[model samples]
Target: MKPEIIDHLSEKQIQELCQLFQSTWWAKGRKLPDVQRMLNHSDLIVALCHHSSRQLLGFSRILTDYVYRAILFDVVIRDNYRQQGLGKILMEAIINHPDLQEIEGLILFCQPEVIPFYQKWGFWGKSDRLEIMIRPAAETELLQEKAGSLMN
Candidate 1:
């Protein structure tokens, strides 16, 4: 069955997204309130839902300055839904989104195993001029979901 593609989600759907995040190793510890906050801070959101049950099946988001750069994040599909072209649907939707078409770059970070999958979209190692940097932070049970979160 064809899934419904949407840009916005309801409260219940937001909870569903948190659940989806849990299915992945990196996002395993995501919490509901944190997910809500993430949604509020994101520039654009893409979600695919089950046609009849309204369940979130695939999701991705973008942060862009509209003309200079855009970073794609959390591109995920439910385990059972993988290999069904939903990831392609999410990527095409992001690339073709009217608000993002003029953006000069789309960036994302993924594990090496999936590198080839994204090459079809023209993604590759960026210029040697810049690379990612990170710091170690302790985990929190509560009272801080965005300890290092910053979005505009």
Candidate 2:
């Protein structure tokens, strides 16, 4: 069956999204409340769903100013649906999305090994003028606070 791209997600789809992220090495053990907050705050969320079954095959989101810049995040295709080009389908949806198409650029951070996959979609890493930087969250402190709360 052909897959359809959708911008809005139902509560069930949001739960599925939480589960999908929880399975990823980068986001393993991500909390549902955190996922819900992310969804609530994002500029856009898109998913690929089976045309017949309507099962969510892939998911991703963008945080954008709609005119100047956009960042892609939480891009994942369900494990069972990988290697069938669903990723490309999802990227195309993002590229053509009305709210994103006029932006100056789209950016995402992926592991070094996955560069080729994104390169095919016109995202370049070799920029003479641009560099990527990050400030990671304080995981240990956050975890301790969470545990401390649970014990109360």
Candidate 3:
């Protein structure tokens, strides 16, 4: 059956997506984002593939501005649905989406082994221009607290 791509997922759908993420090896044991948090972000894009009966077969999202840049995220297919080209279909739909077509660039961070899969969609690592950094959750909380105090 042909899969349908849905742009907006309901709260239930978001929960299902989180569950899917948690079950996967890549995201296993990872904390899921809250549904309200997902909805509050204008740049968030959730693409879901559903069967004729409306069962979710695959999912993906992009964080982006319509013109400048986009970060592809959470691209995955249910274990049973892999190897059927559904991943390609989902990625193509996201990359060629009308709202995303004008983007100057798209980015995603994947493991070394997954480089070839992303390369198929034209993503390349910038060997000379890349600097990776991480800020812990405590730092994020401190920032949020400072911002809250300034607002009051």
- Tell me how candidate 3 scores on lDDT: 0.70
| Predicted model with the maximum TM-score | 1
lDDT of 3 by residue, 25-123 (tens): 545544456544754574756465665556667877778877888888777887777888888888888877888878899888666777888889888
Q: Residues 1-152, candidate 1, lDDT per residue (tens digit)?
A: 78998999888898888988888756877889889999999999998999899988889988888899999999999899999999888888887899988888888978777889899888896567975654436556321343333110
Which residue ranges in model 3 land beyond 4 Å of their true spot?
Answer: 30-36, 139-152
The whole-model lDDT of each prediction reads 0.83, 0.83, 0.70
Position 28, candidate 2: lDDT: 67
Q: Model 2: what TM-score?
A: 0.85
Give per-residue CA lDDT, model 2, range 65-152, as digits (tens): 9998999988999999999989999989988888887899888877777899999889977568865544335658656554444233
TM-score of every candidate relative to the true structure: 0.86, 0.85, 0.78
Cα distance off (Å), candidate 2, residue 134:
2.6
**Clash pairs, model 3 backbone:** none
